[model samples]
Target: MVRIAYDPTPYHFNHGVLELPDIVARLGYEYMQLTPHPEFGPFHRMPKADDELVAALKKRAADAGVKIVALQPVQRISWPEEPQREAAVRNFKRVIEITAQLGVDTINTEFSGRPERSEDSEAGFYRSMEELIPVAEKEGVRINIDPHPDDFVEDGLEAWRVIRGLNSKQVGFVYVGSHSFHMGNQAATLLPQVGDRLGAVFAADTYDHHRSNGLRYITNPPGNSVRVHQHQEIGNGDVDWNELFDTLGKIGYLDREDAVIVSNVFGENEDAEGSALRQLDKIRELISGAAR
Candidate 1:
C-alpha cells in the first residue's frame, strides 16, 4: 500500500511547474511530490507561489489524474545566524500553508544548518522547530527531516535522536537511499529503529566512498573533509536495493498506507524520462519482492 511519488526535478528546467503534472503522468506515475522549483520555490528561498498559483497547480494535477502526495521545500530554517533563521522560518510557514492547500499532509525537507557551527545550528534548529511545529500541527501536515551532508547532524541514528528529542509525531525521518553511506550505511539498523516515524524513502543510488580503502574519490588535500554522493539511477551505484527493501518489509514500512516512496534520480538528466521509468520499474519490483 505504500504510495509511490515521482519527483519532477529532472523536468523542472525544461518544463515549468505548471506542466509537471502532465509530465509526471506521461512518465506513468500516479503520484507526484513537488521538489524545490523556482516558479514555486527554490532551495533556501521564500516560496514564490501565491493562492492563485496554488489553485492552478491543484487543478492541473487533478486534470492530469496525478495526486500531489507531498511537497519538499529546502529552506535554511536551522541557520545559525538569527536573521537567516528567521527568514527561513517565515518561508517554512508558507511551505506548510501550501502543503495544506494542496491537500498534501507531508513535507520532506532537510535540517539546513551549518555543520561547523554544530552547537549553534542545533539550537537554531530546535528554535525554528518550536516556532513551526504549532503551524504544522494546525495545518495537519507532517514534516520529515533529512540529515543531509553538511547539516548539523548527518548520521542516521544521531539524526533520529535529534528528531526524537522533539517528541512530536508531527516530525519524522526521511531515508534517502543515496545518503545511505553518509548515514552510516546501516539501513538494517536505522530503519527498524525509526519504525513508524520513518515518513518517506527516496530511491536513488550512490557510491560507497568508504570502499577501496577510501581511494574511490581523492581530493587535492589529503585531510580535507568532504561528503561525496550522487542521485544516480537505481542499481547504478552501491546501494543494496534488495536489502533496503527487505529491511522496510521487516519494519512494516512497506505495508503502511502513509508510507511514501519517491523516485529522485537526478544524475542522468540527459535521459530523464528513461531514468524515471527505470526507477519506477525497479521500485515496483522491490515492493513486489518485499511483500510478505
Candidate 2:
C-alpha cells in the first residue's frame, strides 16, 4: 500500500548520511528516498560509495526502522559528448549496484540534457540507456525518469514518449507535482495519461502562474530563468490535492507498494523534519478521503 516516503534533500544539506535515518524515524516515516550528498560522493560522476560504506548506511537505516525504498541520483544522463555519456552510464551502474545493496528496487532521476541541444542530447540519452538498461535489468532495479524545467525533454507527454520508446518495464515515469506548470499545467490530464507507467509521485504544491501573473522568481542569465516554482506544503500553493488524488485513483494508483508517493519539499530556512511530518499528515488525509 501507498507508503508515504520522505526525501532527505533538505536534511542532506545540513546533516550527514549516518545522521539522517534517525531524524527520519523520529518524524514517524518508515520509508525514504535518499538524495546524493558530498559525504556519499557525487552521484553524477563516478560515485565513490564502496561496499563498506553501503553496508554501513544500510545498517543505519535498519537500526532506525527505516526502509530506503528509492534512491535519487541527479545526473545529466543526456550529455551530448560520447565520453561524458559513457561516464554517466558508468555512474548510473554504480548507483544501481548501491540500490540493490540497500534493498531499494527503484532509482528516480531527471532526463537531464541541455535544452539548447535537444536533438543531440536525446540521441545521447538513448545511447546511454542502451548501455545502462541491461545493467538495470540485471540488477533488478527500475529507473523512474521525471521531466525537469531545464531538461531537454521537459514536457510530460514527451517524457512519456521517451519512456515508451525505451519499451522496458524496468523504466517508468515520475510526476513531480511542483513541475505541473512547467510540464504544461495539465497534471490532471497528464496523471491519467501516464497511467500504469507512472512509477512514483514527488508530492508537493506549486503556484499556478496562469492565475497570478506576478513574477515568481528570478535567476541569473545562462541559468534556467524559465523555471519559477516552489516546493511548498500542500494548501500553501495552487496544486489541487483532491483532483490529483482523484486522478491517481482513476488510474488505479492507490494502495500499492510499488506506487510510491514521496514528500519532497525543498527551501531555505524551513524546518525540514517538521515540514515532513506535516506533509505526511496531509497526504494520509488525502488517501483516507480518497478511500471513502
Candidate 3:
C-alpha cells in the first residue's frame, strides 16, 4: 500500500531530531520523512549525525512505532563550482551511510544549482552522480531529486529528462504539488512520464502566479525573477487535488508499495497541529476517493 508520511518541519524549531518520531506518532502518522535539521543533517553542509546519534534515533523511532520513509538533505550536488560539487559528493556518500544505518532506503534532495549557469550546474550534477550512484546502489538506497523553484531546471518534464539522463534505476523524481504552477501545472502529463520512477509526492497547495497576466504577485522592480509559492493546507490553494490523485492513480502510483505521499505544509506553523491533522485527514480522503 502507498504510505502517507509526515514532514516534521513545522515542529523543527521546537522539537529535537530524536524527538521527531514521537511527535509524528502523536499527530497520528505512522511514518516520517526527516528533512534538514541541525542535529541530524543541516542544509548545504556535512551531516552532523554521528554513529551514536544514528543508533539512538533508530531506537527512538522504533520505540515510538514510527517508521522513517525517507531522509531529505539539500546539498549543492549540482553546484557549477567544482569544489562544492566534490564536497557534496563526499557528503552525499556519508548521507547514504547514515541512511543505511537508520535502516532507510530513500534520500530525496534538490538539484542545488543556479539558473544563470544551468549548463555548468548540470555538468557538475552529472559528475557528482557518477561518483555517488555506485555508492547508493551498494547501500540499497534510491535518490530522488526535486527541481525546486529558481534551480537550474524548474520545469517538471525537463527535470525528469535531466534525471533520466543519469541512466540509473536508483535515481528517481519527486513531484511536489505545491510547485504545480512554477512547474507549468502539467501534473497530468508529467506524472505519466515519471510513471513508476516517481518516488514521492509532496501534498501542499499554492496559487498560480502566472494568472491575471502575471499580476497575481507584483514584484517591486516589475519583472525581476522571484519564485512565488506557498505551503498552505490542502484546500486553501489552487492545486487540483482530484486531478492530481486521478493522474497518480492512473499511473499506478496510488497502489505502489514504494510510493510515498508527504504532508509538507509550511506557511501555518502557529496552528501546525491542526494543519497536520487536517492534512492527514484530507490525504486519506483523497486516497480513498481515488481508490474507489
Off by over 4 Å in 1: none
- Model 3: per-residue lDDT, tens digit, 13-92? 98899999999999999999999998889988899999999999999999999999999999999999989888888888
lDDT of 2 by residue, 1-292 (tens): 7888988878876788888889889989989889887777576777777899889999999999999889889777898777777778888888989999888899999888888888999999898898889998999999999988888888899888988898888898998989887788676788777778899998988887656354455446534447678888888888888888878877788866688899988863367777888899999988877732
Which stretch of 10 consecutive residues in model 2 shows the poorest summed lDDT? 214-223
Report how far residue 162 has shifted in candidate 2, in Å: 1.3
Residue 61: error of model 3 in Å? Answer: 0.3
TM-score of 3: 0.98
lDDT, candidate 1, 23-102, per-residue tens = 99999999999999999988888999999999999999999999999999999988999999999999999999999999
Q: List pairs with backbone clashes in candidate 2.
A: none
Pairs that collide, model 3: none
